[model samples]
Target: MSSTNERMFTRRDFFKFSGAFGAAAGLAVAVSACAPADTNSSAGQASTGADASALNEDGTITAAISYELGTNGYDPMVTSAALTVAANWHTLEGLTEIDAATGETYAALASSMPTANGTTAEVQLREGAKFHDGTDVTAEDVVFSFQRVLDPANNSLYASFIPFITDVTAKDDRTVEFTLAHEVGVFADRLAVVKIVPKAAVEADPDAFSANPVGTGPYRMTENGANKTIRFERFDDYTGPRPARAAKMEWQIIPDPSTRTNALQSKTVQAIDSVPYLSIDQLKATDTVESVQGFGLLFAMFNNEAGNPFADVRNRQAFLYAIDMGKVIQTGLSDQATPATSFLHEEHPNYKRAANVYSFDQARARELFAETGLTKMRLLCTDHDWVRKCTPLIQESLVAAGIEVEFTEKKSADVYNTIDGVPGAYDVVIAPGDPSVFGTDPDLLMRWWYAADTWTDTRMHWKGTAEYEQLQTILAEGLEATDSATQEQKWGEAFDLISEAVPLYPLFHRKTPTAWDGTTLVDFKPISVTGLTFVGVGSTK
Candidate 1:
């Protein structure tokens, strides 16, 4: 594969030329101002054999997701909200994609695997592919989409996910090439992080384009809805492996878990995500509910900035020993979650037991606290319904260890913002995360928090520490290694260093519980991460 003289857009050029979007920005306005339509549809006739109901009269599927979609609009270049990206997963695509449930790699916009030689990959696009607007997908569109994400002015949240790609170019009408800065272990798996978008439509009216996404996937937007709801209809012209099984799809942004459960029980919505832990047995007895185990884990992170008690290793270890993680998983999360023995779950191919572990020992916790002479700490937790349920248990444990804890709760986005900015205000934070949603390979999962100057270095305040430097060296060696065995060994070395330092440690990897009427749908299965997948799924009606 040879490189072409395709135009490149760097971060610096984006700042200098961003003013050109003024006309398009001004021309852009809310495409739909109407409130989100009713989240549920009326119940139809019940079905037999499987625990499901008949499909809607119009043959549409209503899905209620617990997360909000308004934070970042539908634009692939900028959106970071997990649910927003998942919704677009059906409408938009990339050269390659990692299956959400199976973590298997498959071709999407491109025809086959890219032929890689060192730092470059050659990819051929699928022939005759057309966007929802009926325009042929061209090589120019592929090149332009990569440039936008690589451009720094856009500040795409997903930009850090693909740090290896140095440049991208189109070879011809049907082929494209990617140039990586260095050979990474999971370079191909990370391509799906950025979905390809049409250059002409986006450049013409970026805001309106986001409001109404146009892609080569199986679905097309019926309305340019925002905030509360987004609706889509099948693209009759789509020529892909997973075409739309239903005529229409409606996603209602319901933030409350109870509301979503009610919507599913009433048969108003065909499926719902984030099944409440308490309602799992009830739902499973009467309907279709599953608790799929994946990389979804709640991590306990410490802010090791100067003057904070957590900066001292003794303080950090003391906090971990005080709380019974097993109890947290059992009482708050039920049996759906497993206490994490290693950062990589046991099922992962690269799984390894950590070098050190945190176990319940109230006496050891008090001793460590006494060594630090610290008796009070401010604990920050996400305001998600289930997560909030775990805080009281944590508080009780800490109080039992003779430590006073002040708890504060906020939305998931708000909690991350405080940690990302005001590092001194918080001593500890417990939040749920799943990097495997992007790719299940161990390299991608570890790189999410351990890669240099990423979350662990910047947000967690461990940049200058000795353990941080050791972890970076391990990662660099892992990335450079060509053999799988060598890569696994390097990652294990990094995990050992992390286990000893304890900047942020996993409590447990919880199973993602999802409820849907199986009798009414075919090929529908629950996912382990934040997003809900409906590809290849159809209504029984």
Candidate 2:
């Protein structure tokens, strides 16, 4: 097995980009926003009800996201946050999509499941679908989108998803073919998340395309730039079910939670994406706003490369035992989080919640420290407000357990860049993993922990063992197995082995607290991974 210290990029490194996965493939097309010349029969005029100016006459919804957009050129290939924002503008009907009801995969873009022909997968394009540029969407576009992500030079973050596919060819205008390098399951689910971009539009001007992306989705990017508000207008020509409400959507970048809360209270912004946990109670009490929990993990990741104390299993386990998870969840997290027992979230299907592995036992932690003979270590984390609040709580807990704790907080970019390039920056860092619609797939989990070259697979640096290898094999095979029971059993086995080893001390899963003005915004549903969807949201009175 390759040593975890190897500086190769692996699937685990892809997790950071998973939040914005698939948005990187297509080119942006300049959409003509001006009303068409032919007043009676123009595409825009025909789609917009007789009263075109009053399309969204009710009101507009404004949102605040934590990060700044367009810093990475709005290219999905390099920018994750931009990819997420772009997802609202494009559509890729995949062979399977997450069933909103059961969170299971179901057919969406494809008419039926691909046959088990090791070489080829077939898909039929949905009829009458047209890009925002008024170009008809065909199977050719879908084939091109998938192939683009797999391009080695493009360095698309989600390249691993389709690494097994050798070719994507258009069988006909409405039909496409995929030739696989190997037999793989979950292919459709992976494709479902990929947003298809227009080939002609991207080829026109790749740089300009990022800002003016065009897609067949319900909304279109009307205006966008760095630090400036991103505006999305409803696509009048959208072929899907008409959205419940018509409204213009705006995403304003606001880094400070206090400022965001003030905007919410003052009715300046209709909704805020990540309401700081500290402000949840205050927001909940306000009659003008409603707070909702977001689905994501909040945990500490230990780097176990050479010279790092976390390289020792005993030390890692000791750190876990020293931390008081309950208090951290209550005080640091504002009851919006639950003590995490495993990598998988409780809401996920096939999730086997493990019992507390390292329940706050200062005595055991001290004993482990003595056995390991480790000294004081610095825990590295970002200087973000939440991390700042959480890390100190962890420091206090560890200190009580006879461990001297030091901290080094840097900007978010510096933290990710340093950890990605340099192996041993600090012993442990606070991190979060957002799984794309959970399933019992070890490919992502094992890849995250054991993949030799991944920046995010810090555990692999220290805890690579024969047992870990065996569990990974079991997980890989189970995900490919068609039988649900066998898959569950295999997942259970892997979960048990991982919990026993405690390579990653499950800290807590965060419930993203978001506050939205209910009176102004209508039909708002806070999703699990991404925050607000502008598709069904609209302004009230």
Candidate 3:
């Protein structure tokens, strides 16, 4: 049988899903009736005298964050928390770094990108990169870091993203070579996953190292208190491209959106992350709120293991067919969101419209449900703001399609824990995920949720199936293809197969809204994803 990448998909008669994120659609309204916050208000005024001295002289800035400190520890490989990931941007250094907004790649720890042949790539470390503990970063550290992730025992969340890597070697004190199992088109971008760490530090006391991470980046962890706050002191001796403009930063873990917003309103925090969508207008009337284009998706995942009705393709297709995406966008998500046709969005360079584009067809959904010989399901959903609102609507759609629906709401983490525990427990999962949170490349995006021994093998439970094996083989082939044209075609082929298989698919990409005290912050811009960036930013007030 041909690999999943070689599968031919017949284009079904379907509506072309098309839309940009907010900007062109005139959905950028804040509050028309309420004017913006007074520019001259003390809270709105730029820093002067004592405030200016505190920033410039004392060099400290406190920001309100939605995620808790030491959520998954300071370990780059283990931590999947957004705040930890963002914090790592200051403390850790990968060979290449991806800009969260532009999806552009730039050199971080490595002086330049690795020179690559088909199966091998070589890199040279910067002349004087030093860890926060005053230890020199060497080629040995680079090899150890990559190998640590590659080891199956480590069970690194990002290890699956770099499956092409076969071996990493330290050729010299400053030189390292990466031997790949196959040629990856976006190898440089993939390197962003492996944030270089000192081997000695990690080996000596892994737990302590995770508590107090030491890296060659612009910032060093001064304090990492559990659930309270994380403090980063600028590494004055650091020599790197991106330097900390502020000498010290305090990341306050304020998970409540209202509290975070209030902190910004009272000028208690110079900035805040995860501004509630409903509060955007209110925050904008007083503070600065920026909603950027994002790939953050509400994933509708199915448990594809045996005995689950969702294991059948018809049931999976039926579930999607029932959802009225239009209503979901208007009600659950604002017009700031874009409905997803495939893993690749309309704006993506290599995007090909997915086959079997599920339009709202209750009749078609009923037909698919009849084939399942099942009329009911227990839908498990996240307790996220919009997700909670969207669940009842989803349940209603299922009922309209002649299927009885029952739903249980829980925290996103608890929902995942349940799904990850048993085989036939969950029927469906509606949760948020963003591939761009790791890397922007389509390969990384697909591999993150679809790769073997990853999501499919673990949570979704589609392992040992012909379809799953085919996907694995196809991914390997796609990675091996040297030419861009062939590589893209191969990837596109895999995407088509995935659409047909339908283990899990994205419903839509929602724009992330963030509010900041613009008057107090310099070079502080709201980002589309979770986690606020403070590099090269300081207090202006």
| Pairs with backbone N, CA or C atoms under 3 Å apart (clashes), candidate 1 | none
In candidate 3, list every pair of residues with a backbone clash: 46-541, 47-541, 48-541
Where is model 3 more than 4 Å wrong at Cα?
1-58, 69-71
> Which 10 successive residues of model 2 have the least lDDT summed?
25-34
- Model 2 spans > 4 angstroms off: 1-58, 70-73, 82-120, 152-155, 162-166, 180-185, 241-244, 285-295, 437-453, 456-468, 501-505
For every model shown, what is its TM-score relative to the native structure? Answer: 0.86, 0.78, 0.87
- What digit string (tens of lDDT, one per residue) describes model 1 on residues 338-451? 777788766566779999777898999999999999999998887666787788898899999999889997766566656775668699988776666566666666766766
> Model 1 lDDT vs. the true structure?
0.71
lDDT of each: 0.71, 0.56, 0.71
Local lDDT at 358 for model 2: 59
Cα RMSD (Å) per model? 9.0, 10.7, 12.0
The C-alpha stretches of model 1 lying farther than 4 A from their native spots are 1-58, 182-185, 223-227, 452-454
Name the TM-score of candidate 1.
Answer: 0.86
Q: How many clashing pairs per prediction, in order?
A: 0, 3, 3
lDDT of 3 by residue, 1-541 (tens): 1122322111110001111100000001010001112211122123222233335624677887775432345688776655566777778889887655445577888898665788898899987998888888999999999999989998887898888888899999999999988666788888988899999988987766776677888888776544256777888778878888777888887767788888989888877876777788998888877766555667788989988889899999989998888887887666667788877666556678887687788888888888878799988877655566677887888888888878898765566666775887788888777656567566777877887365787788887888888888887787778888887887888888888898988887666677777666766655555667765567644
Candidate 2, residue 222: CA error in Å?
Answer: 2.9
Error of 1 at 487 (Å): 0.8
Clash tally for model 1: 0
Backbone clash pairs for candidate 2 read: 8-453, 27-202, 294-512
- Higher-scoring candidate on TM-score, 1 or 2: 1
Error of 2 at 354 (Å): 3.2
